[model samples]
Target: MSALLQQRSTGAARDDARLRDRLVFGDETAFIDLYERFSSLVYTIAARVTRDRRAAEDVTQEVFLAVWQRPLAFDPAKGSLRGWVAMMAHRRAVDLVRREEAHRRTTLDGRLHAEPLGHGDPVGDQVSDADAAERLGTALRALPEHLSRAVTLAYLEGRTYREVAVELGVPEGTAKSRLREGLRRLAVALQSIHAQDGEGP
Candidate 1:
């Protein structure tokens, strides 16, 4: 039984080699097989970087689509097919992280400036926080639909302003302005709520 298992392993390796050769030659079936073999691995790496399951799935799909679109670019002499795919996955994941960080930095700068409330006022602090959140939500909902979407995409999803602009069919500057305006409105609304609650803003 051990000998039989060894033979099967050797056969699978040979089949994988053939499939890789076919991939280099631009065979669709080989590409599909390669995707099937590596999609989960790609997704796992993407998940580690993006820290979101859905984004990981998106990255995985994009990586495979890229592979399919540029099959001719894969140089077998330079690296194994798995290694090449892994590199693509890593690149996509890094891109996601960079885009997310840029969005956070762009939109949340003002909010982060608010000093934390003093200690020994947990109940007041919690109430103030809840009121601020509610007012911000109301202000966000009142924004024009496009501007609201831009704000949500940039701040909530942590998408880059450029990516939000692309998704919304707006200019990059428009995306930035929408985010800036939305954040200003949210900040004002939160301040009003705090003032009403006698929190002194």
Candidate 2:
């Protein structure tokens, strides 16, 4: 048993050194090798912990993505690559489950506690809604270029961050960062925008 353990350790150490070297040099092949070695294990960990196939897949992708983007984060002196990867998968999986739970609770609470909308005269309300939407569109156009483009791609075009990255010719991480920053700026822009007839949002 001890012999087998030592053999496994020796193999993992070799992989750690070789892959670490290639990864630091930005080698796609090394990324592929690392993914091939550990992705299934990561997926299984995520799936078991999250109990959602889609979420597990997302978590697995993110785990590998972090490794690819930050190769130096793994230190051979501190731990084996396999252990680091496993722990990352576990932590990310748990985080995903917690976020899912929080989203569920927020959604449930919103449905339970939301103020009921009064529909006084349906036809009049529809006309008013159309007018409000027109004003909102004008306000949206008044935003700065980056904020406008981000908001348009994400909200208007219904693009996810991945799709937004492709559409905007930016990295996926950059796309998300832009969207988050844009949303914050949009709130402030909306307050200042007085469209056509000059009504505050």
Candidate 3:
């Protein structure tokens, strides 16, 4: 990891380790503090991934509930608590998208006798888009922590480069570099997926 990332990770570990201990002991106030600290970030991730306000709200609630119920599930040794919450929200949001897509497909199948499925089909287009979004999310999760944060803040949250730098406690040039490299990696991931599907980039 870069020096900046290492410093950030160390700080997060220290902060989360203390909170995790309180949570493990069933401290209600600690849980409340955790929620207050991460709720907005978690909700923002859910909202961006699911693109539905209601689903985002549901995901945000579910994430914190799970945290309270299974505090030990969070291993501070593995990652920051904030990252874990954001990841859970993203995962839940993606799951909601998949479930909704499946329901739509089932409903559409029943009406398929009236209109055959083919090119230009709206349902097919939606399915393709959802699949791409899911793949992108997977690729994003696969990125290194600093790069992923930079990309998420800049693209998902629509922050400027300077804003990302300030948020990450990094130089503006570093933020831009991370964003460039992250997007390049995402493009590669998408290309590989397309290649696997027999679709040339």
Of the candidates shown, which would achieve the greatest lDDT relative to the real structure? 3
- Candidates 2 and 3 compared: the better one by TM-score is 3
- lDDT by residue (156-183, candidate 2, tens digit) is 2334678778877889998898888877
lDDT of 1: 0.64
Poorly placed runs, candidate 2 (over 4 Å): 1-8, 102-201
Best by TM-score: 3
Question: How many clashing residue pairs, candidate 2?
Answer: 0
Each model's total of backbone clashes: 0, 0, 0
What is candidate 1's lDDT per residue for 59-137, written digit by digit as tens?
9999988877777676655645666888898778777777776542333322221323235422122323456555655
| Residue 131 CA displacement from its true place in model 1, Å | 51
lDDT of 1 at 68: 72
The alpha-carbon root-mean-square deviation between model 2 and the true structure, to one decimal in Å, is 20.7
Ordering by TM-score = 3, 2, 1
TM-scores vs. true structure, each candidate: 0.42, 0.47, 0.51
- What is the per-residue lDDT of model 3 for residues 3-116, given as tens digits with 9 covering 90 to 100? 654665577688888898898899999998998788777776666555556777898899999988888898888866876887788777766766775442223121121232
Q: In model 3, what is the error at residue 32, expressed in angstroms?
A: 1.3
